[model samples]
Target chain A: MTSGLDVRGITHRYGKKTALNDIGFSLDKGLFCALLGPNGAGKSTLFSILTRLFVPDAGEVMVDGHSLAREPGKALARIGVVFQQPTLDLDLTVRRNLKYFAALHGLAGKDADRRIETSLEQVNMAERAAEKVRALNGGHRRRMEIARALLHGPAVLLLDEPTVGLDAETRSSITGHVHNLASEQGLTVLWATHLVDEVRGSDHLVVLHRGKIHANGNAAEIAGDVSLQTRFLEMTGGGK
Target chain B: MKAALICLVAIVHREALRFVSQRGRFLAAIVRPLVWLIVFAAGFRAALGLSIQPPYQTYITYEIYIVPGLCGMIQLFSGMQSSLSLVYDREMGSMRLLLTSPIPRWWLLFCKLFASTAISIFQVYTFLAIAALTGIGFSPAGYLAILPALIVNGLMLGALGLLLSSTIRQLENFAGVMNFVIFPMFFLSTALYPLWKMAEASTILRDICAFNPFSHGVELIRFALYGQVDWMALLWVLLAFAIFLSGSLWGYDPSRSMVRRKA
Candidate 1:
């Protein structure tokens, strides 16, 4: 089967500064990958380009054979995005927020209702559908956004720093849940973060530093004979 | 097309509902204009000394002449209020949700202008009704006649807000845009006083008011309130609307990657 995401020879710049250079990667179906990077590593820039929030200066992004520039709507329909910041309308109810997303993805009527309920059930937020987003804790709010992202049944999920401000237990639980979704549901995942603990041995890891990919390999293999943290710092040129 | 329309409605509905939920906003919309109408206009009635414009057949009080200007004020402030909230929405991240939708960016920004115009028209009618209750009245035919004119002016001001929202960068800088936009647009326009009145003050000030698009907005309202169409002023408002709307679309282009840095 074809890969879920194909990014080739991607280069992006901001004025005189290069945010991403010669970045290329691909993910097959059902793979969970972490975009591990340090600050100023161009992770957000890549996400902006990938999500169609910004256009890259050069290169291409293909999702399930749909090119972003040629057919952005169709390509976007196949992918889901969760921004690092919470984007929910605090004044709106959780279900209302999810329904708003459903409409954006072109799901309506009975099909939309079913998907909304199912997606909320998956993220453990079904019961709080009536509550406004302001009432939910940070972890639950993030989970709500995750459920909203999945309402369209996207083939690939792109989460940018999903666990930025959560407690340890909640963070791990959310990570485990998304990992399970990728493994069991044949969902491809690209999770961006600065945290090292979120990466696992079996998962694919792309070490991004200063807008360039330093290393890309299986986590256990790349960090072999050393702590993943140490290997990461050393690769990014952050060694003491 | 269906998906795009739905996305537009969802974003527009979110704003409309927010306006409905804020009781203070509704009252503030009415009261702010009423204060100028009752307190300020009453005091300036004699000193302003208006001639009979097309809308005024004979010697008219400053309160009566300023009604169209006050209506223009309602649209102007509502436009700026919409702009202020756009800034707030960007800071809070909700604007990002609207921006990242896969539809063409111009369509989305236009949707915002259209929505803001609807809300502004609603407020103008309400202020008109309250004005009538207080013995400040318009010709009923004049009232019906001004509806389309109000919409045109509303879109012009809202497009301006959307444009300013794109370039202002941060909420901190929003005040600067307001100062540069709001004060000049109001003081230089016929909103508080007429162009002829400004001519008495200074020829430079009169020329500035004569050229202001907002002066045309007030003229459109004034003529409409007298049950006559001001096609010349209508053309100016439409032209301003097109320019501001186009500028906003260009400013927020994804190719610029403006939001990534602005946010």
Candidate 2:
């Protein structure tokens, strides 16, 4: 069976500086995978390749059984993304933003309205649908982005450091919400971040360090008696 | 086909909303042409008398002559502005969302060009209206006839803008590039003077003006404004549009773009 997301022998570089080297991982359906990496651990580069914004120098990306390089449209349609940076149109209202995204995915009219409503409600953002994005707080904006990503009902969702600047409360809530999405909606999630607290013992964890996968297993299996923080620091050597 | 049409409409709708909200941009587009019509044309009229050109049935005032060129100028600036917004969109992360969508990249880029063209047409009509109010009017038929010409010319310039946006790395670099593109394109084209009048001063400059695609674009609009067709001008503009469109498509290829290279 096709995994929700699979990356095999993926490699990328800028000149002689390797960003990602022979990185391989896979997530089954309904699994929440945390891609824990440091500042230069190729997290952004990996995200770029997965989204097809940047073609890898080598390797293949399979999204919901579709090969990204061969059938990008089919593969891309099966995934949703929430970028590390704010993608909202601050000048446009929340509903307009959702409608615009819906149209890009070939959804419109009543079908789009229904999806937008459901997605917004899922993120508890339905009440603020009429407000402009400029009026929203950072946490609310992040929630709206989550809602936007879920609008198309993709099998996999990728978020790149999604809660970077939010307050502590908002960060945990957003983390909890995405985890729930994986568990409840049977969606696969690949969340890229360095936050060790976000990963639970039972969750799938891929610890990337210095352009390599240092650990790939259940968080608890990898961490043993120590916390994920100490284990990650030891594996990455705290960056020479 | 239905989905493509919906995507096109949404892209155009977004462009329209942004245009409406940014009142300064609308003003700048009109005022630049208006200043040329009132101040520059008035000063240059006595100094540069025009003989009958093929597109012109009889000798005309400088204001009457530069009207089509001004329309082209508006489209040119609007096209560059659309490109500027693309750079901004990329910086702000909105472009990432657009690129990650399931639609073909070429289709999305074409929709952006079409949207920019639509806005350029709107600006062109507004300038034409103000020109009419100030007593420079085309044939009533000319107004309707110019729509196709405007679309063709708009796409040509918008495609050029797209090509530049894909190649140019930063927003800071855009203003300098715009100065390079906009001034040379405007001055060297038939926008200011007929080739014969230009030949009176320098054959080399006149030859350059004749070869400039933007000049052909201005000529295309000029003929259309008189309810006539300039087939040669149409052909040149269409060929340039095709070249720029293809260049933009290639420039935006994931492998070629700097965004990809940096990754």
Top-scoring candidate (lDDT): 2
TM-score of chain B of 2: 0.98
TM-score for candidate 2, please give it: 0.98
Worst 10 residues of 1 chain A by lDDT: A100-109
Backbone clash count for every predicted candidate, in the order shown: 0, 0
Per residue, candidate 1 scores C-alpha lDDT tens digits across A106-203 of 66678888998999999888899999999999999999989988888888999999999899999999999999989999999999999999999999
TM-score of each: 0.96, 0.98
- Against the reference, the lDDT scores of all candidates come to 0.86, 0.93
Q: Write the per-residue lDDT of candidate 2 for residues A1-240, one digit (tens) a residue.
A: 779999999999888999999999999999999999989899999999999998899999999999999999999999999999999999999999999999999889999999999999998889999999999999999999999998988999999999899889999999999999999999999999988998989899999988899999999999999888899989988655
lDDT of 2 by residue, B1-263 (tens): 77788889999999999999999999999999999999999999988878887777888999999999999999999999999999888888888899998899999999999999999999999999999999999988999999999999999999999999887878899878668998889899999998888898899999999999999999999999988999999999999999999999988887767677672
> What TM-score does model 1 achieve against the real structure?
0.96
TM-score of chain A of 2: 0.98
> Candidate 1: which stretches are off by over 4 Å?
B260-263
Candidates' DockQ values? 0.61, 0.80
